[model samples]
Target chain A: MLLNKIIREKINSKLMLTFTILSCLLVVLIFFGLYYKSSPLFTNNSIKDLLFSSEWFPLKGKFGLLPFISSTIWVTLISVIIAIPFSLLTAIYLTEYADKRFVRMINPLIDILAGLPSVIFGIWGVIMIVPFIKNHIAPALGISSGGYCLLAGGIVLAVMILPVIIHVVSEVFRAIPQDLKNASLSLGATQWQTIKYVVIRKSMPGIIAAIVLGLSRAFGETLAVLMVVGNVVKMPHSVFDPAYPLPALIANNYGEMLSIPLYDSALMFSALILFVIVLIFNVISRIILVRIERSLGIG
Target chain B: MDKRKIEESIFKILMRVATLSIVISLAVILISIIYKAIPVMNWGMISQTPQGGFYLGENGGVLNAILGSLYLATGATILALMLSFPIVFYINIYAKKGSWFVHTVRLCFDILWGIPSIVYGAFGFSIMILLGMRTSLFAGIIVIALVILPIIVRALDEVVRMIPQGLLDASYSLGATKTQTSVKIVTRQALPGLITAILIAFGRGIGDAAAVLFTTGYTDNVPTSLFDSAATLPLAIFFQLGSPVEAVQNRAFASALILTIIILSISILARYFSGKYNKFKV
Candidate 1:
């Protein structure tokens, strides 16, 4: 009976360790799997041309990723720009100023927004933002557009990521010791002065980490951006011009991958780019977050 | 002093405006979807599979997509939970405190969680080709399981980490082995959180379209076997909206409404169970 109990315990522990190792191995597997699949495209085209040139002719063997990359940057930039102030302000309000009842009421709304699928956001973008831009905003700016442009993609993405940023930033704010705020207040600092000088200064790293996470999310968003961002393969001169982001390129063209010689490889290469970029962003933010947690003595 | 007072009031108003706008946007999305969906939503929409030329806006239902989503999400959630539970157990119970291995494992999960589902779809497709398998329900499940594995593990890990050290010491003082303690004590303590994590992952898996796009070949009929192609609600909405026909587009709204309802209920259920189980926790 004693031997059987020991053996069972030993087997259970070993089994758990094996599963943990496999979970860690998955990350490495994804990285190399994408690299191996995309390696074929490098044999045909130089890395510079693949990334820099704007020409994307799968039949002619010319695949330039500049247009897609530029569009992604523009859209992500627009989203971060729009989402940062709004999310930060909202987070500050909820954490610092709002009473318990107000916070409680707002929390579920934020949860619902976060829980909504990307596809639903896509449909909303197509229905509301697209027409609103096509008829009002574009014409107001003296630009003619079909409404499916970088701006539309950016606005939709901003809304989608707002809940994410708000959640993180609010948590960061909540982590600030009430003593710190009280110290400033007792020193005759106004409420705004206390937040501006003490809370914001202390949580700067956490805030930046939250924004980076939101940026990473925006980078890889596929369906919603794919829907509103006109899938035109060209360099966009302005937010009103239609452009295709990298994820959109991959999602749109994967079905026809078998038709071209190196098409599958090219699409895989885009996925790799997205993978690498998101990984770097995540790592950077993780380091920042970890440092903050360590300093705060909370994990 | 006067300038500071002005700034304080101005910023306060700005923050309130921002909060109000966000709440308004949420209301807008829910209202618009419900408004558009109400016209076309009916018993047949959820009860029967597509008839002839459903994509062209003919008579039919999204029964195939609904069933497919349920099957795919259910399978993936189960697979992910099997892996995640063990990983979380090992990290919390077996691993050394603040060890580098634990930290590395956590970093890996975080990175995996950050990766977009589209990349997972691409990777899953490549794996399918390499394994000599076709796009089918099995492929979709595997990919989605990968997508949600990190989400489940991280969530459960957070909850398990909160389990008080005294609780574990008490079990050990009673002469229980680590495995036994983990299985009996830790499991019971974290049961509410575990369920919430599982449900949240399920909601995400079912709502995701990109990860399953290339892996699950869509069909109008419900899948009868693991190897059979499956249709999902998100993909159904996508394909239907692509059609130029207005009726097809309306059906897309109906599909979105159904997806939203399922997701919202899961979240509400998660909240309810978590609150209910709070009384049991120390």
Candidate 2:
């Protein structure tokens, strides 16, 4: 009996140790894989040329990533801009002004929205938004092109990102001490005043973190944006122009990457850039959130 | 004071508009999907595999894709559970609360959670190339398991963390080993949330197209082994929509409708279970 018990204990400890280390080990392996695969880009190319050049022809031996870099930045910025106001107001309403019954009904809806597949959004974007833009909005705006452009991509991304920003911001709003709002209200502040002076001030850090996280999501979104964004490898002059972002560039070209000299390396380089940017955004937001939790004495 | 009242009312209107827009957008999405998908969604399209030139408006079905998605998601979710439950159990039972190691591990997971699915695919593609592996069900499973691992761990961690510390103390006072306490008390307390987490991860894994685009390497056949290239509902929709033919495009919507129904049912089931658990607790 004692020998069996000892063996059981040994097995327990071994299992625990192995599982705990597996997470860290997998992360390290992924990082090493990306780093090792991306190393070839540095051999024949200067980092400056990769970042600044607009020409990206593998046949002609020019590997400028300026077009994709600009596309990614522009699309991300536009999507975030479109998403923030609606998300902020919705969050504020749900947490502060809405009735409890209403909040209860909407909360699950938001969760459902968050969990819906991106492909659904992609299909909607292609069938609904693209044609609507091409037939109505584009002509009205005097832009002569198919609607498969940066604008469609941004709008779809905004819809996909809305739930994420709203959820996080609302959570932050919920975390604010109720007594602070009560004090503001009892001091003769209006409802909006209480929100502006008490709730927003306390949760500003968390809200910023939420927006940054949303931006990271928008930056790395693929497939939906891929379906909408016309994969023309050029710098778009306007939101209506077809342009290729980094993720789309990688997804579109990586299948045939080995065919062109340095093609695979350049695509790997793009992936590395995307990975690093997302990491930086996520880390920054996490640090800020940790600080917020520490200050508030919540975890 | 009067000015402030007017501003408050205006702000209220803005907030209502913002919230209503969300409702409206969701309504629009559903309405459009149903209207477009109804015509093409039929019995045969869902039951048979493709024959010749399926992308050219030919008569074929998404049976391979539906079955492949089921196999891929089930495999990945099981793999993720095997990896995540142990880690969660360790952090809760063996390690001290708020330890540096726990903090670092949580931080790493938060970072992983934010990393895009495409990035996971790209990273997985590189590793696959290094191992001289082709795109197959196995590659999809590994990459997708990695992608959903953080979600499962973080969700289950939150659930387990909510189990009162006193429960652990109580179990210890009764002379239970750490393993026993964790396995019995912690698992019991967190079972419902664990189900919810798995549902969420399954939905995520099954719906995701980017992570498996290159890794899974789509095929029209049901995957017979881990090495077989598998078609998925999302990729089927993607390829069908890419076609210039109208009928093929309609089939894309049909495929999407099927996927949406599957995801919606899973979520509803998740909500029902969690709600039931909450009532039982109270």
Candidate 3:
């Protein structure tokens, strides 16, 4: 027993370190994998060469991530722009105006919506929505191929992200102390005005956090966009035009890559860009949350 | 009063329209999916192998996939739990000095939760390719579990943390061994959290399609072993979307509805149990 105890005592630190290293390595490996796959695309000097060279031709050995980066931002902006108002308004109604009973009723329903798997949304978009758009909505919009257009994907994505945005924003709104709401109303601000100015302002960090989370979520979604967004290589012009996003590009080609070096590297490059974007969003959200926590004086 | 009331009425109507549209869409989606998905619910659809292409349809029953998802997720969750519980327990209980490391891990895990499944999928794809199991269920489960470990740890920590420090003080004063106190007393307090954590992971795994898709490509047969390739409900939806036939699309809808229900039920159950625990404690 003494010998066994001694052995455990000696090796315990080793065990702990192993687990810690594994966790840290998982995070590190994601970055390393990106660099390893995308090494062929290095164009110039350290910072400017890696990020700003403005040329991404993996096949031709020119690596330009700017266009893909810009396209992603565009899609994210479009989805968020459509989602924010609806979500904010919904949060307002749920938290500020609705009765507790009514709020309880709506809350779980929205929670369920948030929990709907992305693949299901992909199926719905592909089987029903895209075709519906192509046959009905597209004719009205005057788009060419109704299948993979940006508008269709954006709208589906907006709906997929709606429940998340509303649920998070509502929770943030609900967290605001009741006195704040009462304080606004006491100053002759109407209920709507109170919600708009006081409650909303107090919840801005959380609301922004929610939006950034949504952007991250939208940025990484694969199946929904893959099935609906036409995997066109060229940059997309309008929401009406068809274009591929980063994750979709990775999913479509990763499994069946006949073109060895370039295709695989391109997929990895997009993955790298995505990893960088998500990492930035995460860090920013953490810093903002810490600031909010400090300002609130309670966590 | 007349003109202002008239404008207020218009705004109210507009708000009502917008709210109703959201509600209507929600209902319409459920109804459309359920109605379409009803025909695909036969047991035979699962029991058999992919056979005569339903008019140039993909071959194979999803039997292997169902078993594969179950075992792989189970295995991964078990691995995650074993790794997390002891380490998190030590940090939370004994190694107070290592709080920073623990907290940093917790933070990364939280960041991990916010990450959409595709990044995890890419991570799995990378690891799996190295293991030479490019389209395997083990890869799928590892991705799912990695994505969910933080959730389990957080929930377990919350449950344990809420156990009054008084209990630990009492046990130690009574000369109880730390191991005895942890196994018998500390983890008992955390049982609810552990269950909640498992359910949370299950719920997340059940809903996650992206990570599993790349790691475990769409195989119709449910996997009987951990090492085999297979599909799950999430992947089924993605796979069926590209099918040329309407019947297959309907099957996807039905599968989607089933998947949503499973996710929804677990979430609802978690809420109920957690709420009950709160009330019981109060």
- Most lDDT-accurate candidate: 1
> True-contact fraction for model 1?
0.80
* Local accuracy of candidate 3 as per-residue lDDT tens digits, B1-282: 666456545545555565556676677667767777776666644565556784255544545545555666676678678777765566566556436776576567656666667777776776666666757777777788887776676778767767777888888788665555677788877766677678777777777777787777766555766666777766766666567887776666656766767777788887777676664341
Better of 1 and 3 by lDDT: 1
lDDT of 1 by residue, B1-282 (tens): 699999999999999999999999988988888999999998889998999988788899999999999999999999999998889999899899789889889998999999999999999999998998988999999999999999999999999999999999999999899998998999999998998999999999999999999999899999999999999999999999898999999999999999989999999998898889978998
Which parts of model 2 have CA positions greater than 4 angstroms off? A1-11, B280-282
For A1-299, candidate 2 gives per-residue lDDT tens digits of 76776688678867886877777676666667787887777777789999999978888767899999999998899899999999999999999889999999888877877888888998999988999889999999887879999999999999889999998899889889889999999999998999998899989999999999999999999888999989898888999998899999998887789998888878888888898899899999999888877777986
| Model 3: CA > 4 A from native | A1-21, A43-68, A142-147, B1-22, B39-41, B58-60, B95-103, B131-134, B176-182, B218-220, B275-282
In candidate 1 chain B, what residue range of length 10 has the lowest lDDT sum?
B53-62
Q: Give the worst 10-residue stretch by lDDT in candidate 3 chain B.
A: B54-63
Best by DockQ: 1
Q: How many Å off is the CA of A60 in candidate 1? A: 0.7
Overall local distance difference test of candidate 2: 0.89
Ranking by lDDT: 1, 2, 3
Each candidate's interface RMSD, rounded to one decimal?
0.8, 1.3, 3.4
Report the candidate with higher TM-score, 1 versus 3.
1
RMSD of each: 1.0, 1.5, 3.8
Model 1 CA deviation exceeding 4 Å by range: none
Query: DockQ (Cα-based) per candidate?
Result: 0.84, 0.74, 0.42
| Model 2 per-residue lDDT at B3 | 94
TM-score of each: 0.99, 0.97, 0.87
